[model samples]
Target: METSHDDDSLVNFADDQDDDLDIAPNPDRFRDAVLYGTDWTVRTLLQQIEQGNIDLSPNFQRRDAWSSRNKARFIESVALQLPIPQIVLAERKEQRGTYIVLDGKQRLLTLAQFAGGFSNDHSLWSESAKVGPLRLSGLKVLPDLNGKTYQDVVDRAELGQFRTQFDNHTIRSALIRNWPDEDYLYEVFIRLNTGSARLSPQELRQAMKPGPFTEFLSVRSGDSSVLQKILGLTAPDFRMRDVDLLLRLIAFQTRLPRYKGNLKPFLDDTQRHLNASWSDEQNNVVALVDRIEDGLEFLIKCFGSPREVGRRWDDKRFDGPINRAVLDVQIASAFDPNVRRAVASGALDLRAAYIDLSESDLDFGQAISVTTKSITAIRCRYQSWQRALEKAVGASIQMPVLPNA
Candidate 1:
């Protein structure tokens, strides 16, 4: 990392570190050294901003998240030749010769807007509307300047002085297109922005260089209203952490036969595989989703029924085994060939099966509890059910009848 901490340029805006004040002349520290003279021009910077090439990572705050007054003040300060803080840029490997914004995002954006002529009506700027050409002639001098005011300075210019002044007042220093290495840039981004609201790793992942899977999830999270509805019903106050868990579970379910503890590396591997597979991976995802949905449906059908018992059976009623049996049904549905076939055939009536089982006075909960005896009983029952289903399906025969038969 190439860090520039020139004490001479450091501006101590206030003595109180505890005060809620933004530090001035925040030095541009680069962890990675970059080849100089490889920098971009003002026009190029504006073009990148317009093209959305300049991605603001979690380390960078949102555009216009700063107040309009602060933005206007910043613009005014720049127009009057006042010092603005240096911008921090991290070289990203994924972007390939491009940089990610760390600090000074707001100031850089404000300058870009001015250069692009996007500061017409202050309200338009307030709304972050990128319109109108910047009227360089309208730029005023600092009101608190000790020297001549802006109008006085500009008015007293000779015939060709205006063009010369405009030409000389360059605004190209704000762009940081050169960085030596990614680590240096990342360290600077972390340390310099320590006191500020820090970005979580997930957020950083999204901002810096998100892979296709992350982008896909973001798009799906917004596009699939049905999924959101289902999620809200299941977990209303769902957080990003919970979303990560869901991702892990989905990965585990989809990539059966292989299980790993670490989700990050697993997700990374999955993304690489997905990228390599491209269209085929998408097909697999669709298939996996369908299977999971079918499994859930089977669970609901086999367990969602109320039962009443007479005086003799009432005292011996069991709910624990019943619930465990329901869960077991769900687990079995995931791996059962018969269940897969039933779903594929679309001929099995799960509701009827559920109703019939509900009337059978079975102590399902006790049959699948944590105890060894319960587990043994549950396993035996599962094996019996598997064998009976296999026989019913005529697994050894050349042909088998559908479930309705």
Candidate 2:
């Protein structure tokens, strides 16, 4: 399932230095792996899916796979016996019979979704969501088949007396097994999805770095309704844009000591370590995330509405729309001890104090808006916050010192 970019409500900046970064293939090394082609009739493929042979979970899909119109056109081509594009899959190393999709996940899902009644626990990203039958529409080549279900097509061909080409056509597929690691397969996806469905940095990071920490991040990001509301997300971003922002928060809150101005490598380094030590570190990780969530909720209280979370003042008044730069500093402040005390105690008139500081502190004002990737900008936010929070709470709030600070 592919998601449109409009869902990302946060403002975009040219920081993070990640737009052009990628893990290039190791040039000095070569490895051998087995690759072969296979055929699958729709019925057989559905059977495999029902039997849990294929993985089409949120992690496996490109999210919302494709639009209904695109799916209908593809189904029409199948009905016309046109040569469809090849699908690619990788045979699981431990469980050879089970497979994970390297490419063509949506095509396979489309087949299952159109078939109707196809149910698998992990098929779709959502737990309650299932692959129900789709009514074919917008069929250009096969206008006659439009609005027909799979069974409708079958029954029209013959109510037990005839058969349709759709019921028996075989899809071309290639299966690669004995890959060196899952990372290699993810790289395969990076190469395969270079067209209209290129992977975002967060998406690529998710693929390239697979671990319990990443899995934990995925689960929490999808399940946290409060977090979703803060980000104006009713559901998880199919493109993992919501997840991207959450990752930034997690990195800043938990690993500010390791930040080196470049967010991309800093996040990558932190995730790699936490992922490897998740078993021993999970409890602490959960606690940190809870604190971060606490900070998020506290901010909402200050603004009086979740929708106003990332909102800041414009030149004249506090009328600017929600943006990512505001979120960056706000999230970074979540771990401050004084803020935590305010969060725990429900400190009074904190909203007034917050607005006052934002209005009076010119440096904090500028830091929350432009060229905010530098140590000066970040330190200004935390340092200025110490004064505001100390005044509001009537106590000393130890500032969270960053590496370059």
Candidate 3:
């Protein structure tokens, strides 16, 4: 695992602690009349799975966390006609007729696997073992099911009745049809998962809010080649820390001046906009990603391996876990097409300028200041970096400014 801070850059945006804001209080606050739907049977739910209606690859939690033994227990529970907990699903209005799994992924997956062989896609199914006859064991109440596979139960004439009963079993499901407000959906996800286990905001956001940009981030962060070359990480953080860094870079580059003190809300708003699936925006995303890659490559060529582009960024003096503010400013600044051209054409003495700028304590300190999330701090840092880059490249490129200023 990469050495991330105990207090991660993304985790400690405003403060290390989460505020106790009373955003929603009751079931009525969820607007149950319109969005809520009643429970569903295991049979009906399986039909939806077969029809390709439910989304299993929500980028939130690791899939198939439950062991085969755990799956066996659940399958045994179903056979005994036990009343399992309800599954919660969020209907994706934007995708039109698609639903994402919010909770009960394990239970739903167990039921499906028992019914049919596992699918090849690991995301769709919970476990790695391909769809085959489910083998159940370690049961206490239903001792007869011990060491029995699904085929055994189905083939035996005497046990045939048991199979029929198991097939007719039901599991409750709560459908959230319309989460009108983004904040409301955020709150709902937090609320729903609190009882079972705590899920980080990033995890919930990835699962609940699946979109084009989020998908892009997932792919970009997962690319080991890029991550290994630039960030100096042999293995990516399974918790998706790299993804968070990429998001922070995009937010600062595109929406820095408008940034308020809070990072989560700012990121949330930016993500909602990016999720709109605009053709032009998609093209721009690709371009920005390419520019970032090019910039990182340029740094590596100039400075050699384990290229430290930030955190006291000089060829000789580079050390420390890559600073967040430094990373944001440098990567965002590198997105300029003119900057890329200058480096390529030898117009920019990037090696000398970058090393010189790194040694300037006065300039770098302002950017990596204590209250770094504030608008003043964000703008100051970005402008400082941009000015340095412009000077290095000898270009009069116009930079983005605050709307009012």
Indicate which candidate wins on lDDT.
2
Which tens-of-lDDT digit does each residue in 351-386 have in candidate 3? 566567657746456546455555666666667667
Highest-scoring model, TM-score: 2
TM-score: which is higher, 2 or 3? Answer: 2
Model 1: CA > 4 A from native: 1-44, 47-70, 92-97, 106-189, 207-214, 222-278, 283-405
Q: Model 2 compared with the native: what TM-score?
A: 0.67
Model 2 error, position 15 (Å)? 6.4
TM-score-wise, the better of 1 and 3 is 3
Error of 1 at 232 (Å): 13
Model 2, 1-405: lDDT tens per residue?
A: 233435443333223322333445773322566778988876777777767787655454434536788778877777777787888877877787877766676678777677634444445525325334677898776677778877786667443321256657788888888877545665676667666444545765675567898888877877777777776766666656567767777777678877767655777788798899999989988987787787788778767887767656655455433455567666655556666677668784555665787789889877776646666777777778677777778877664557685
Summarize candidate 1's per-residue lDDT along 225-290 as a digit string, tens digits.
233332222221111222232343355455423323332344445545654665667766656545
Model 1 is weakest, by summed lDDT over 10 consecutive residues, at 10-19
Q: Which stretches of candidate 2 lie over 4 Å from their true place?
A: 1-55, 58-108, 115-131, 135-200, 316-325, 332-337, 340-362, 391-393, 399-401
TM-score of every model versus the real structure:
0.38, 0.67, 0.58
TM-score of model 1 vs. true structure: 0.38
